[model samples]
Target: MKYSLVASLILQGSLVLGTRDLQPVHFKAPSALHFRDIVRNDTYDFGCRPIAHPTEDGQFTLHALLTESQIAHLTEEYEDTDLSIHRPSEKRAAAATAPIGSGDRFSGGTIAPIGLGTKASGSTISSILNVKEISSAVQGLVSTYGVTTLNLPYKTFNGATQFAAYVGAGTDKSQYHLYLSAGVHARERGGPDNLIYWISDLLAASKAGSGLTYGKKTYTNAQVKSVLAAGIVFFPLVNPDGVTYDQSSGSLWRKNRNTKSGSSGDSIGVDINRNFDFLWNFKKYFDPSEAPASTSPSSETFYGTAAASEPETKNHVSIYDSFPKIRWFMDIHSAAGDILYSWGDDDDQTTSTTMNFLNSAYDGKRGPVGDSAYKEYIPSVDLTNIKTAATAAVNAMKAVGGRSYITQQAVGLYPTSGASDDYSFSRFWAKSGVNKVYGYTMEFGYSTNFYPTLTEFNQNILDTNAGFMDWALAAISVGLT
Candidate 1:
């Protein structure tokens, strides 16, 4: 899909031309732009948008078509600010001031403090895992577990390359009953981290003397061994193209890279989250022209030319279809401290008992009480008692730290469409006759203009990993028993 060229006049003396490509378009400013005015007014309307190319130079050059006044405003607003745009007071407020101690035998260095070590090695597997490499790696895991790999086909945005992969269970296919995936949102820093950490933890726990227990629950090595005895199917980086674009071109990129024909040549990406098949067109019904569109290739909320148009989306769907036993699913992302549930559009809808069960297993059975600052900034939805796997994970993280965080649907922050969790839940309910599919969207932490320092980055990963381990093992215990 490709878009026609278009132009629009801006508030001040600025002309905006829309073009499609991986590289962002550059606009020259006549004078210095002010930052204070821009931030106050939300100039540039900077959220997430699509770009033409995936390169550092390509990203740095792309400019939002803000007017001279807006540019001037932003220049001044961000000139002296650090990458995070976080004020010193805000940083201090968000910081964990109280000391974190390991209880009893768990005290001292044995308890790894946040960001305790150098960032974990091999965080950039996306750079290494191409279609061929990913396929080979999955095959190796499948072979080791003595299971059959379900071959699935997918198509890319360019339509030039096709993606194929195999899915299967562990050594004893009957025992290994879960389907696993991560990196659904290419732009999120934690998506890849979650995948890497998950695999590492699973492998370590599989070893004879790893001593990794499933959270607070006491599971014998034999039981832990039984859980691993039946293996999992993983698709770590489903959207490689988007991931590459995010890392190299723009941090705010959110959508498949497919181009489409449209009025504003500028808008040219589909919100893959809104591209799923369930309640899929809600965005179109509400905003119609703005997003969730049946037409308009350049729309950020484009629901694909039709459902499953993008290869990446289809590949994931195929994974679900092939693996009937995938009782649990999780799609990881970052920045938002949220764990959203199904029926994201409304708060009154009822979720399955299994989903509710897992939600409790994951989110400590209670809603969070926001911190002073967060209470002031966060809305009520963040405090809602929603049974969602994502919220469960957030509650677990909070339990360990004694901090309060939000848990609700993604729509509480912003409305999204075709999200993987939504799709997974719908499918699980339809197929299993039981909502055994406990799906979640884990938002790690903020990592936009400012990437976390090495310490902050490491801490975020470890905290999330520990939280997920506790949640996963507990859920498994409930399911098996």
Candidate 2:
């Protein structure tokens, strides 16, 4: 069968959020762990201030400008931390302290453009395509190639719908699945764009009757055909309402548009990243100083009333469970230059191929635990083939644009419970069998500003394309193994 008609036959199942208890969980935002301490906090670095409390709108408006000293402090903290895997060369680092000004495209300046499509990459492409443009592009691919495009069965509080594009090489039902999803937090605009660009490149190559190339290696027709035999699913924008609000209103919305009543503010959303069921709101998953879920509904990282309560979270879980064979799952996020693996809730002392290779590449021999609560645990599967694929993905990314993304377990970045990446991996890996899915959160861009200006955003997209491509290719290879 031709590829274009393939996905249309796949079921666009109803949005079935299975029956679950809806008891409201009082998530009190820890007073000690203010907004300043959150790993994903970009308020100071970007032109924004933290609200004293959550508002009717779940996000803070991007209006507060930071002082020179505050900007410097945040920049220093970001640079000095281990989470920052690669730094700009010495020449760029020297200019890090300059007074914030309208930044030039090439110079490592602080000021970034506020809008998208202000700059063009080629005659056909520009920086930062909006949600509409992105969705349209995906549809175009599906129309031309007969690939599957699944509309998420649920709409946001504002009635915004989302979709996922599936690209596969064959019609085999039991083919291994490789999942790539982005835009979980609405403010992180770059995640979906990266996947879109990667998909476009892959589809273009497939159509031209040519093979895809990575670094010095080129996959011939037979290789491409064989590798693509597996299924690749890309959920580009999971939080459409949040992205729309952030782009259109310049608000820093970070959660799905869920208009439920909360404990403190009238804010009506839940942080989708923290709404997953795995380790959901388990106080032990976070440090006393860093309670992962906020008690206040208005706070940024608020996990919802119940695990998987939000429709978006339910959609993600439904997709994962529905897939027959998943060898790799990547929940792409932004503004951090890290490739994080599972066990985000505790210190990772597991002995598996994935852990060994990830720690070796990014952490040397000894994998550093993210917190003191973690004790050594064993993995259910031997991760040799999976580790090989991961090493290739990381190396390929670095080879492209000379931009290196640090690889570590998710907890290495910060202690957070109910994150999607951890949940995705744990579902398979935590099982006592060898049928494991290598799950990850591939964070793009090194800056705190999830929403960068058109020029910078485009540049980051271009620079990271190599890595994304390599990761996709590796995903195909691992599926075959």
Tell me each candidate's TM-score: 0.59, 0.68
Q: All models: lDDT?
A: 0.44, 0.55
Find the 10 residues in a row with the least total lDDT in model 1. 367-376
- Among these predictions, the greatest TM-score belongs to 2
What would the per-residue lDDT of candidate 2 be over residues 270-353, giving only the tens digit for each residue? 888878886565453333554545656765667888888887887786676556576678887775565666556555555534
The positional error of residue 365 in candidate 1, measured at the CA in angstroms, is 31
Per-residue lDDT tens digits for candidate 1, residues 1-481, read 2232122113111211222222211322222122222212211422232111112332211223343455555457556553112223455335542111112221321321111112233332212233234434444444443324554576667552433222223443334445556555555554554444444444444554443432222334454455454455666666666665554443344566666643333355666766777556543333232232234454445566666667787888876555555666667665444455544432222333343212323222111111111111122232242253454566666654523445554444223446677577666435555334656666665413123444445446555664565455555654621
lDDT of 1 at 392: 51
lDDT of 1 at 24: 18
